[model samples]
Target chain A: MKIETLFIDRAIRPCEEIDYIIQSTSLEPEYVENSKVVYDHVNLSDDPITKGKQTLYITENHGAVIKKCPGTSHYTCCDYTILHTGTFCTMDCSYCILQAYFHPPLLQYFVGQHKIDAALDEIFKENKTFRVGTGEFTDSLIWDKISNQPAKLVRKFADQARARSRSSNNNFSILELKTKTVNIDSLKDIDHNRKTVVAWSLNTPKVIKSEERGTASLSARLKAAKECERWGYRVAFHFDPIVIYQGCEEDYKEVIKSIFEGVRVDKNVDSSSDGVIKQSLGILPESIVWISIGTFRFMPQLKQIIENRFPKSTIAYGEFITGLDNKMRYFKPLRIKIYQKIVSFIRQYAPDVLIYFCMEDEEVWQKTIGFFPKKEGQLGAMLDRSVMERCKAC
Target chain B: MLNLQTTISNSALLKKRVKQVCLDAIDLSDESFKISSDNLFFSGNKSSSDNSLSNLTNLSNLALSIRLTGLINPIVLREIDDKYIVVSGFKRVSAMRSIGMRETPASILSHLDFDKDKTYDFRFYEVQSALIAISDNAFSRQLNVMEQARGVRLLKRFCSSYDIAQNSPAIFNVNMGESLINMLDDIANMPLSLHELIESDKLSMSSALKFKQYGYDKSLIESFATLFSKIKCSLSKQKEIITNIHEIAAREEISASDLIESKEISQILDSQSDNCSSNVNDENQKANLIRSILFNRRYPNLFKAKERFSNNLKMLNLNSGMKSDIKLDPPADFEGRDYTITLKFSTVEELAKKANILSALTKNPLFGDITD
Candidate 1:
């Protein structure tokens, strides 16, 4: 959030989107002919990762506008597609893989909106349903104040959904704006037509305070999700990178209870002729489209980064083993235990809500959720089906 | 010109005072000295009492040098109540004794008027004498850890009774900081074998200090010091191994002695000892093997994971082909969820062969285990 310096590529200086972003911030942009200067400056600092959070760069993304998520080989992937708009994020999480993935760790925003629109249009013409998100490399809504990209993307998805509704063939797409921020002001007035799923990454209060820096609180995020739900927008929740610590289960149970309290759910009741009534116990079962749960996992190289950045962190001091994917993870039994507890808590509160495991294998699914996706793309299809059943445009 | 005149006048004045002092002492004649080597006492100097110093490797060379050029510098001694205490020239006297010479030239400074006053403490005289001996040896070459330890040990005694500022010039001359003094005091009380290991540079001073700080039992310290000298390792590895064992013992609520006597550690030490006796050529490799075993014992979960990964790699059976060309790249320490399979080929035939191997490998269940 505290971007100390803004470096604009000479070519992107004339970009209208770049001008809009510059006009909104108090940062005076320093025009650079090449991005290598910014990279060199960041890498030369004493703490490159911390310094990187303070530096911003505006440049063009020459690569594909939409790309497949590079999921690992052994893990089951949901076939999620990413709308590549930038690299690196402003929020500083101790266990974030971006700390080691990017060398200079520069916060780069791509100024290629035309390329993105064309890519989205091509996807809209395709016969298959696409589940696209823009929060992989960066937060989806953190840059809302400057560029208003989320608002534009929501409108674009809404238009595509409306077009599909009129066509004879079935073609649909969902744009999930996943974020840890509560920047919902720009999203309030947009007519999304339920094509945009506003999702918040949820965590316990302890983790948010200790590890997640510069992010909204748990209550604030849920409040924003409640606001979006009231606007006729489909809402989703992601309890990802769930850190396992002492007394974490009770904390997570309370969070689950709060989620149901904040949002509305469908209920059914039956009454006999004697005026007796029996009500079904379900919370947010119909309104909350889906929830994904993924435990804390990291690349081997991230161990050193976490140690250097957060020396007092005990998150890495767990019983871990190298899985087939060659990443350090909690011991199989430990991960299964944590997941089972969380899944049970969720089922107790919202039994009928769509619950899926993000990047988890079939065995884990079988053990925790009592079922697994039949095939590779089965999870994606299930998510698309959930969207169709929940959203308005479908 | 005024500076030059002052220098000449001061030199003359210093000569006149030296002559007067010598006259008052009344022992200017060389015959007054007993030149017999047996008459000289080695007990006065603590460093000379070392048995290792008596058998110095360079004694013969010094003797040969003296035979060719004679002793240019006379051995210095102090007359304490008709007894000559050696203040300097321990090595010279040692070389003379090695050549079986009974008599040698020496200069003796008897108790003078300077020591008559209460301001001139006899303890100060003893400290200054030891300092002179240490400085003489230090100027010729670098004193080894043992000699330095002896010197620092002697100075530490004076440090407690006198102000540091008053005695700092003598202490600091040998680089004796408080920490170094503490280390030397600890080392002086250590067993002779450990002292020899430290003196020979096999064990570092910092590691020795850490061992003391960890409160290792005397027996455990001695056993480890002996084991370390037999096997070779870098200083950091040595420190890490010691510290790791200490920490593991603490975590397990066992004494360090009991931990070192554990079956796993004992087996490793015995096997390495056997390997060492068989004359293993790669010392570092042996050391690494020992360290790996220690680390595995300390972290069992990681050990099991590494074992499983190694077994899984072997299950791939990349060697089934007559010419193996495939490589599996797992993430470092299995800390990430990615694996890469690379096939190497130099010719079209090799490429075809690799493709066939890959097709066969894809059918195996282990392939799924590696890449879902």
Candidate 2:
């Protein structure tokens, strides 16, 4: 959160977003003729990754603002779309691919609002159901104090959803703002119309403390989700990069219980029934749309980075093999076993909620959830159906 | 015309400064004067007499160059009252003395330049001489590890006495940085055998430093060096073994030397054949045995569980006429929870054969033991 320096591109003229960001932070402005100065300085430092994290660069997107997710053909992708709002994240997870994916690893935020708007318009014109998220390259809410991108994008999607409803179209669009932060103040007063699903990437308390440096605690994330649900917003949970360690199953089970306890409620139960009556749980189960379970997987290059950066991390020591996508993944049976346990827990609590796998095969689906999507695009359609049904768009 | 004039004037000034500095310190009336090789003494403890200079493998080449060029470059010396001390060119001086040369060309720094005051700091003068020696060799060639270590040792000693920049280790031809200097310091204090291993390039500085830091006994380090030298394992493999062994010893609350002397490790070490017929397979087996033993000791529970699982798997004897057809799901190590048995078959007959094997395996008591 403490940015050491801010490098502004000379080509980027003053705008509301850039001005808001520059004024919100106390980091001295270092106006550069080109963005390469920040990159070269970061790369030449003693610890490039750490130094890069401390530095911030504001530049134009210079490319398509909306791009398809870089999913491999070997795996079953969910047809997720990435809104290229930024790159690099503040919070450090040991198995995070961004550590190796980016060369200099500087925290870069694109200030090309016109480009993003144009891309979104193109997406809306085509208007099939698309799950666009800004959490791929960076956390959606990390720049909450500096920039209003989350609220801006959330309102944009709300307007688009309204337009679609007025036109009586069956197809709907969902803007998913996924993050590890509990910074939901910007989303509090917005009329999202349930088109903006506030999602949190969840992990066990041990991982949250050890590997996910500078992230909101599990309780804090669930609390934020609860608040979002109360604000008439559908909420989602992603247990992605679930690490396997000693007692991880029990830890994850505790996390699941807390999630349901914090957000979902048994609406049929009355609080004043009898002596042993239990209060109706807070947030409605229907408001909770989908939960994705993805085990800890990493690009092959991340192994050495994790070893160097987080030497004490035992996450890489799990039984792993090169997956079809060429990422190091837990052995199939091992992944399936972890998934089955988690799915069983989720099913016990909220059976109607849409549960899907992120970048998994048909076999993993059948083995873990006892059923696989019949064909390609079924997973994406299932997610879209959840959006329309839960958000009352259909 | 201006550039040529500037170059000529700069050259004249440089010659004048060199002559003035030399004359102010010592009598240099005879510029090519010679001093007896025996009269030239090396001031520092790191000399050929201390066996530190024994690794200068290119000394013969230098001697050959001197014999041909007739000592074109004069060795720098410090005139301490009546004694002549060789400050730089220890190798050249030793080479000249070795070839029965009576005298050698030299440049003398008078007592004024290297004076011992009432508050005398011997290390200061030693470091000054070391800098000159390192600079003399900087253009000649790169310094070996031992030379770098010796130079850093002198610089560190001087920096401790004088207020100077103690960060960068890029002195002369050695640029190992400060951390390596610390490693070299630790290496310098290690036992002779460990030093020999490092000097011979059989063991790395990092591994040697780890051994020293972990308090590995001299005999244990020597034994590993000996075994590694025989097997000719790669540096990474050697590092793995050393690291795991150290961890196991620390975890078991025993000395590393004691762990090396354990029955299991000794057996693995002794299994290597010294005969000329020993092939690559034998060496690989030996390395594998050592690694397996170290891993077992490090993770006793996992190893025990794996052993039990393997034995139970053998008890099933679920041989479907081929080894690849039937296998345990999730394999060994219990990294995953599910223990379903998977059998692959191509035809109905093969499936029936696999079913029969599974049926027999189900009856075995060890079938239940496999998951446990």
Find the candidate with the highest DockQ and give its number: 1
Quote the chain B TM-score of every prediction.
0.68, 0.58
Across A1-394, the per-residue lDDT of candidate 1 in tens digits comes to 5888888988764867888888877789999998889998799898998888888898999888999989776777888999998878888888888888887787888887788899999999988788899999888998886787789999999999888888974768989999998888899989898899999999998999888988888777877787787788888999998987768899988788878865222121111224444222222567788999988888988976876687556566555567767777876656778899999999987787899988777668888998888687888888888887887663
Model 1 chain B: worst 10 consecutive residues (lDDT sum): B15-24
The true-versus-predicted C-alpha distance at residue A210 of model 2, in Å, is 0.8
TM-scores for chain A over all candidates: 0.93, 0.93
Clashing pairs in 1: A325-B337, A325-B338, A326-B334, A326-B336, A327-B334, A327-B335, A327-B336, A328-B335
Q: Rate the local accuracy (lDDT) of all candidates.
A: 0.71, 0.70
Per-residue CA lDDT of model 2 for B176-202, tens digit only, reads 545666776666556655554555555
RMSD of each: 13.5, 10.4
Number of the top-ranking candidate, with lDDT as the measure: 1
